[model samples]
Target: MALSIVYGILTTVLTATSWRLGLAVDGILWLVFLVPIILAVIGIINAVNGKMKPLPVIGGIKILK
Candidate 1:
């Protein structure tokens, strides 16, 4: 969530300053955004079966705790 927001903001800033850089940043951000959704889906499946599992990659970074 926070990471997505940060990427969005950075992409916006880069867009205003440099179109090429903004496109590059946006592409990278697109990939980054998918990670959370995938993790959330995995988490949901785990929860439905009565298990608590952290997401891979970004799971340990407790930003909102």
Candidate 2:
């Protein structure tokens, strides 16, 4: 959610500056979008299996440790 917001701002600024840069950033973001989907699927699978497994990458971030 936050990522999308930041991406939106960046895309707007980059596109306003140069269409090519915006195009490149947009392309990269599309690929990056897959990460969240993968993580969500993993989380759902873990929950359904009644397993307390941490997600990859951002999973190690603990705010209530």
Candidate 3:
């Protein structure tokens, strides 16, 4: 959620700055969006098997309890 917000802001800023930079930001945003969907799929599989596993990179962060 935080990442998406930050990326949105960055994308807006970059778009205002330059078209080339905005395109680069768009590509990066796509990759960032994929991370959570992939993690959620893995998480769902683990849940079905009764396992509690953290995601690889973002799971360790204690942003919410």
Candidate 4:
């Protein structure tokens, strides 16, 4: 849930910027968008595979822990 929210927010914010700045900004938005998704994907993969894989900075920076 957290991963989804983080990615969704970043994606929306950056995408909004991209609308005015064009391709380079769009590319950056894409890059920023992947950060949280990659974490969630890794987490899902680890959970499904029966292992613990911490998402780089975020898994360590747990606010609700």
Each candidate: what lDDT?
0.85, 0.90, 0.86, 0.71
What are the clashing pairs of model 2? none
- The order of the candidates by lDDT, greatest first, is 2, 3, 1, 4
Clash pairs detected, candidate 3:
none
Whose lDDT is greatest here? 2
After superposition, candidate 4 runs with Cα above 4 Å error: 1-21, 62-65
Reference-based TM-score of each model? 0.51, 0.56, 0.56, 0.52
Q: Per-residue CA lDDT of candidate 3, range 5-60, in tens?
A: 88888888998999899989889889979887998888889999999888767778
Report how far residue 65 has shifted in candidate 2, in Å: 17
Summarize candidate 1's per-residue lDDT along 1-65 as a digit string, tens digits: 78768887899999999999999989887987787799888888898999867776667888885
Candidate 2: stretches off by over 4 Å: 38-65
RMSD of each: 5.4, 3.3, 4.8, 6.6
lDDT of 2: 0.90
lDDT of 4 by residue, 1-65 (tens): 78557656765776677755555555675687688798888788888999977766766786774
Native-vs-model 4 lDDT? 0.71
lDDT of 3: 0.86
Q: Which stretches of candidate 3 lie over 4 Å from their true place?
A: 49-65
